[model samples]
Each structure stands twice: as C-alpha cells, then as structure tokens.
Target: MQIAITGTGCYIPSITIPNDDFAANNFLNSDGTPIQHENRLVIEKFKAITGIGERRYVEPHLNTSDIALLAAEKALTDANIDKEELDYIILAHNFGDVSSGQSQSDTIPSLASRVKHLLRIHNPKCIAYDLLFGCPGWVEGVIQACAFIKSGMATKCLVIGAETLSRVTDPHDRDSMIYSDGAGAAVIEAVENGGKILSHATRTFTYEEAYFLFYGTSYRPTAKNTKYIKMYGRKIYEFAITNVPKAMKECLNESGAGIEDVKKIFIHQANEKMDEAIVSRFYGLYDRSMPKDVMPMNIHKMGNSSVATIPTLFDMVRKGNLKNQSIEKEDVVIFASVGAGMNINAVIYKV
Candidate 1:
C-alpha cells in the first residue's frame, strides 16, 4: 500500500518580531555583540548561534488550535475535499489550548468536535486524536497514516503538525528567540501512483539523553514563566552530527535506495550548523559526488516550529521554492529529523 500527500498548507502567526525588536526587548546589542552582563551575553549568543533574525508569535489570546485550523482548512481545500471526507484527524502538537486545561487532558475528540462544528464537518466516521512526539512527529504521523489506510481503517487522513512554541518560550531566556508559532497540515490519501511515502526508518538513542530538550507542565509551572524553550546547545549539536547521518543511511538501506539515488534532503530546520554537519557527513559517505540540497533554513525567518518543519517544507515545495536542484520527476526526496526525544526518523519519496 502507498500513501501520497495530495494537499499541503501552513499558517504562520501574523505578528512579526524583527531581530532589532527582539534585541531591544531583551536589552541586548542588535548585532549580537557580547554584552557586559552575563545574562545579556547569553541572549546575544543565542541570536548569534541560531541565526534567527525574526519570528512570528500568535497573540496571547490565540492558541495552537486556531493556527492549526487555518492550515488544515487550506490543505483540505487544496486537495479538493471537504472536511466531511476526512476519515481521521491526527494532530501532532507539543502545545495545545491552555484554556482547555492541562495539555494532554485536552482530548483530540473534544478539540476535533469543536473544530468540526466550526467547519461543519459532520462526518460520523471521522475519528480525531492527538499525537505528541518531538520534531519527528510529522514523519511518524505520515507513517501511521499509511498504516491506517493499509489496514482498511481509514481511507483519508489529515495529519497536522501544529505548534505554538511561543506559549512555552521563556521570554527572559535567549533560547526563546529560536521558537515561533506556526502550524502545517497535509492530506494523506492511499494512492497507487504519484508521490507515495515509499519507505521510512527511525531509531531512539536514549530517553535520558532526549530529556535535554522539552516543554510541559513538568518543565514549567506558570504561563508567565514559560517564555523560552531551553536546550543544551552543545549536546544537541553533538547528537545531531552523530545520529542524523546514520539514520539517513539506515533509511536508504531499508528502502533499497542508495545515497546517490536521492535528489534532495529535507532535514529538520533546527539550526544552521546541524544542517552543515549532516550534509558534510552525507558527502563523506558518498564520495562527495552525490550532492544533496536542503531547504533554506527558515530558522532565521520562522524559528523552530518543531514538528511543523517538514510539512511546512512540503507546503513551501508546493509553493515553488523546495525542489530538486537537478529536477526530475522520479528523483528521490529524503526527509529526516532528529528531535528532543533523541530520536531520528527518515522517509523517502519519489518526486
């Protein structure tokens, strides 16, 4: 069985916070020069390291659901399908409506019912649920969607990776600069031909190692204190450099595709350095002849949207920026991500 992403869409918050405003708000140098104060220096260092120039944050009144709804609507419309045609709605979110109480307590069915009412999707067979993983959520969700269709459980699925990281960011912390609010959606349909999810591979290194990057009730107590997403930068960098390439190789081996067969690689836009490291590793393995192109690191423009990264790239590709450098219909595109769980996943697609 095969699944193709027939529709793709994304929603970025309306508020655009420029780098200068960010620097000023945090009381730091605009060019990220080292400030005298240790805290200020850390903030500037974050800006310098992540290369994030601007980011969008939803208004305090808005939530992930609102952003997700917008993207989901666009995706459904793009696929020329109504909400009523959807068999399942799987939301991949690290953050949800705070007004709905605790994160996990806010059931997907309840949220989906509200969304259904708002969108008038009166399909009784539609089952909605939430799946929370780190950045690998979208890849995993797509894999699961294919399984559901293969099992005859659902014919059509709306897999959405939506995040309002702004809600979890520690405003006082410099790390917050690399987080933004956004959502992306894809309509996965079981199809025989055209852009099928050919194969996927995933691995977990250590749950303890994964705990280094996280956000939740256990991590923070109050909303006012949740303005930054913290990370052990050096540790994450080391992990990505070591694991991403290995994961990609394993995926290619499992899919029966050599590294040379891939035309483009869409990696999680976590950091610029991470991208360079992965590409370097890919070249080292393949004699430096198989050049792999990656999506323009949007971290400078949109920060890290966590799970939303891949699907956002999918939307961008559909919009005309992400494409094979060589340009061939059968050229392979490899999607990979290494997230907080210390987990890595890769999927191959024939464009």
Candidate 2:
C-alpha cells in the first residue's frame, strides 16, 4: 500500500501586517502604557534574524475552525473527492476555535469534529480527532495517515493544520511578532503508481527544556498568567538548529537516500537563521556545501503558524505560489519541523 497526496490547499488571511506597521502600533501593557522596547531596533533585529517582513492575521470574527473548513473544502475540491469518501479527519492544532480576547481553548468536541460539522460532512464512518504534536503536527498527521492507509485500515484521509495563535499571544511581548494565524490541508489517498513517503522519524525532548508553558503545568499554573504563551526564544533556536538537522540526516539515511538526493526541504517557519543553519549542518554531514536554492522560505511573508507552516509552505510551492520553486513528479523532497513540545519530525518523500 502506498500513500499519495492527491491535493493540497491553504487559507491565509487577507490582512497582511508589515514590520513597519508593528513598529508604528505599539502594544500597551496592563498599566495602559506601551511596553518598553525600542521599536526600530526590535523591528530591525527581528527582520534580520527571522527574515520576517510581513505576516497575516485573520479578522476578529474568524475562528480556528473557520479557516480549517475553508482549507479542507479547497483540498477536497482539488482532489475531486466527496465528503462521504473521507475516512478520517486529522486536525493538527494547539488552541482550538478561540475568538479574539479569549485565551482558553475549546477542544471539547475536537476541532476536527467541529470542522466536519461545519463542512456538513455527515458520514458516520468518517472519524475525526485532534493531534497536538507541536509544530510538526501536520507532518505527523500525514505520517499517521500513511500508517492507516498502508495497514489497510483506511482508504482516504484528510490532514489539516489550523491554528489561531494570535488569540493566545501576548501582544505586549516580543514573541507576538512571530505568532500568526492560518490553516492548511491535504488530501491523502492510497495510490498504486505515485510518489509517496519513503521514510520518516519523530523525536521529542520533553525533559531537556520547558520552552512553552501552558496551564496546569509546574512552570505556570495561575489562570491569569498561564493563559498566554511564553517561550525562551534563544533556547528554542539553539535546540532547533542542533537537533533538527541531525534528525533529518538520520531519517534520510533510514530511507537509503543522501543529502544530494533531496530536491527541496520544507522546514517549519520558526526562525530564518535557525532553519538555514539546520539545513547547512545537514549538508555538512557529507562535506557538501549547502545549496541556496534548495530551501524556500516564506517566514518573510508568513510568520510561524505553528503546525500550519509546513503544510501551507508545501501547498504554496506545489501550486506555484512561490517564485522559482516547484515540486515536480519524481522529485525527492524532505519536510522537517521543531517546536513547543520540543518535538521534532522529518519525512523523506518522493513527489
């Protein structure tokens, strides 16, 4: 049994906020005054480090599941598949259906369940659930789908990564600059003759660092403070740059492929410098100089949407949304991500 990505789709907000816009509109503290940070310096350093010039945020009325439905609709339509034909809906997210000013998540029915209802998918056999594996959730979902297909347990599956991170972001904090909102979906179906995932690996270091703190954890438990997402950016950057590349190389070796065999790499849009360094280190394993054109980045246009980044970036390149980048048939591509849970995952795929 083989799994082929039949279609891919992503939904980004219409409103694009530039770095200058952030510099102009300062986020005020709880004391009703602007937080202390040199706007010009922060903007400059942020752009220089993250390669982020602009990012998209949805309107106040939109929720997490809304963009998910839109993305799923597009993906299903692109695949020419009907709702009833879907065997599973795997939603990758952290915060679910959180409107503006609401920090708490509503995962009672699961975001995938809400999306199925909103999409009017009434097939009783179609199971829906949520996966919270940090930034690699979407890729992990695809991996799970592959298992289901290859095991002959399912025929078709829809994997989605949708997040409204702006809801939990502390505007007064610098981390807000890296948080955005979006959704991306892919339709995976069993195929006899098509490019498929060859091998993949996932790793987690829950004990090494507690970078992101949520409610009920020992790090932060107070309802008032724990609602917001906080992180040690420096630690995360170091962790990602050191670990992701090594894991990617290991996963590549598992597939009997080399660094030269990869045509492209879609890494999580966390940090520009960090991602570049990771890819460079991966190439360094074989004493090969890093190729500039292999990694396509959209962090300049799309901030870290957590789990949504990989799928969105993949769809963008696959559909010719990016300049001078394209995923053709028979091309070998790699996807990798590292985030919140300090979780890292990589997949070697043939397209």
- Candidate lDDT values, in order: 0.73, 0.85
Considering summed lDDT, which 10 consecutive residues are worst modelled in model 1? 216-225
Summarize candidate 1's per-residue lDDT along 1-351 as a digit string, tens digits: 567888888987888987656555443232334346755455556667777778887777767777778888989988888778789888887655544222333445544455555667777888877777688888878878888998999889988888877666554455667777788898999777777777888887775686767652213233332223567777888888887887788777777777767777878878776777886786667666435354445677877888888788767766775434233467778888888777788888776
Which predicted model would earn the best TM-score?
Answer: 2
Q: Write the per-residue lDDT of candidate 2 for residues 1-351, one digit (tens) a residue.
A: 578899989999887988787776455544446556778887888889888888899899989989998899989988898889999999999878887777668888899999999989889899999999888899999999989998888999999999988778765566678888999999999988887888999998888665543422112222255456667777887888888888999999998877778999999998899989999988988789888789988888999898889889999999999999998898999999988787989999999
- Per-candidate TM equals 0.85, 0.93
Question: Among these predicted structures, which one has the highest lDDT?
Answer: 2
The global Cα lDDT (0 to 1) of model 1 is: 0.73
Give candidate 1 regions above 4 Å deviation: 25-48, 99-114, 216-228, 289-292, 321-328
Q: How many angstroms is residue 349 displaced in model 2 relative to the true structure, after the best TM-score fit? A: 0.8
Q: Lowest summed-lDDT stretch of 10 residues in model 2?
A: 214-223
